[model samples]
Target: MSEFLIYEQQGPVVTLTMNQPEQRNPLTGNTAVAEFLAAIDRIDADNSVRCVILTANGPSFSAGGDLREMKRQSTPAVSEMDIRQEYRRGIQRLPLALFNLEVPVIAAVNGHAIGAGLDLACMCDLRIASDKAKFAESFVKVGIIPGDGGAWLLPRIIGLSRASELAFTGDTIDAQQALAWNLVSRVVPHAELMDAARELAGRITANAAHALRLTKRLIREGMHSRLDTVLELSSVFQAVSHKTPDHMEAVNAFLEKRKPQFGS
Candidate 1:
């Protein structure tokens, strides 16, 4: 029911759209942030939802934080403590919530994604961008860092040297450059962005939901562990996978030379 975030369900794929196109979908507002977080929580609670496509309907995907709002909160000479507290309540919690989501998040960058907008895209498991899309870590130009987890996510995606250059210069990169740098998984013409994202979601939706969740958990958490630890973790995941009806059906179908039908 929130005006800021709109949710649409398509079988196992849930699409969450930023509805404030007039404001370019800024994430800094308390209402928008709370609504977005609530929508994500709803998606996580839905067992039938396996994937999420994050996108916006505006010419610019998002203009990042609403600097005007920030200024309004600061004009009264708000203390550092007040600003920090506001950030914690409104901005800092975004990345933490995104990271803890149980299902995969796919960012369909339909247009410009600057600063906090780029951070949101970075949080997703995969990014599919349109040719018109532009990405920028605009913090340096404004005398700030990419506050909402961009500093951590950028290096992991594109290596330290590139992340440093982008963070330091605050230069905008085109979708092609983003894809070449592996910041985005793929880039297509503006007309094809949603279709590409939907196709990818459909592919993921065809897989065993339980197996996919276990795989995602293993990959995300196990990548930082040692080989022995990864193997042990995989063993645990395999045991869990074995308990799923999908696994049994897959095994039976393989023996019968047939395709398995997965339950919703």
Candidate 2:
């Protein structure tokens, strides 16, 4: 039902492929954000989904916002406040929905990820880059800023200094440089990108489903919460995880020296 997303599932892994190859899958000034939020909401509610791979169909992962649309809306009729409100009700929702997603999300960067495009990859829990992938935090080049939370997300992935360099210079970095900066966990052949993503997803989905969600929440909370707060959250999550059917199955499977069959 999504206008721009090609939602496909294989076992416990869901793949959200941005299907705008010609337009480079621009997130804003189009249906991408709405489709993404809807899909993410469904994934959050579906316990069967343990992992998600976010990718695109075209040469560019995403070219960010639509420049022609921006130019059209730059008229005097559209005030500064109007643009601010537009963003608040538009692209800003992407970070919120993606960040709070219950299942782990992996970005399979196939090609160029520019400006907000790069930030979208950062929102994922993990990034697997194609050898031909290129990235740039290039808002400055367009006389704009990263209105999609790149300032926060980029710094957490790479160091503040490195993120600053990218934002300030607005320069593009290839997949190898991204790997060196720890921007992406792995860089594989472009032809093998999806295979690598699936292989990683397989390892993640092999674990107990409920536990994986709980562990991801604990990790996210630990990023911003105090140690004591994280400890409290961990205890609560641990207690809940201990009660899951998957947990019991895992324990029994280990005891019996067999593989676990998780219903969820």
Candidate 3:
């Protein structure tokens, strides 16, 4: 609903674009964070939204925290505790919301994803970057740390050693280097970024919505969960999937050598 985020729905796929190019689409300010949370809520409530492509319309995906806003808010009256509380109630919400959302999200990194912006991409289920894109876990450069769940999310995506190097050095890496580090799933030409992202979303959205959501949950749980626990959860989800009309249609259509038409 906020002008900071542009939400465009096309059938089962929704493209959430960060629209403030002049500011390089910073995520710190109240408006962007609130709009992002609201967008997640809206997507979660709409079953028709099977997939999401999070992209930014700018030379930078996001410059991370709004330093201008931070300067404006940084007053002698505001204690360290106040700043901590602000983080908990502010940009931190974006990672938590994206992580918990049932629908699959693909981050289409069109340009630079620095600091918390890098973590934002990590929060998504998948990431695709444009050839011109760059990434950095850059909090250390600004004399701060990754306060928006990057410490947890980054390690999970690219392993501890790589994540540690990025977070500690605050070095920027190009799209190819990101792909080599397993930070992004793929890299495309800048002009083709959206097309590649949409194609990936289409492949995901073609499946049964229920199965996709449940499988995503299973993957998320499996990340920090024991094998036996994940297996038990998977068994339950599998049983539930078996009972869905879409599952039956998929099986039947496979046997008949025809495309399956899934239903809600």
Which candidate comes out best when scored by TM-score?
A: 2
TM-score of 2: 0.98
Which 10 consecutive residues of model 1 have the lowest summed lDDT?
Answer: 216-225
Alpha carbon lDDT at 199, candidate 2: 98
Clashing residue pairs in candidate 3 are: none
Q: What is the TM-score of each candidate against the true structure?
A: 0.95, 0.98, 0.97
For candidate 1, what is the lDDT? 0.87
Error of 2 at 36 (Å): 0.6
Model 1 deviation from the true structure expressed as Cα RMSD, one decimal place? 1.5
Candidate 2 lDDT over 195-244, as tens digits, reads 99999999999998888888888888877899999999888888888898
Q: What lDDT does model 2 reach?
A: 0.93
TM-score of 1: 0.95
**lDDT of each candidate versus the true structure:** 0.87, 0.93, 0.92
Q: In candidate 1, which residue pairs get closer than 3 Å at backbone N, Cα or C atoms, i.e. clash? A: none
lDDT of 3: 0.92
- Lowest-lDDT window of 10 residues in candidate 3? 68-77
Cα RMSD of all models vs. native, in order, equals 1.5, 0.9, 1.1
**Candidate 2 residue runs with Cα over 4 Å from true position:** none
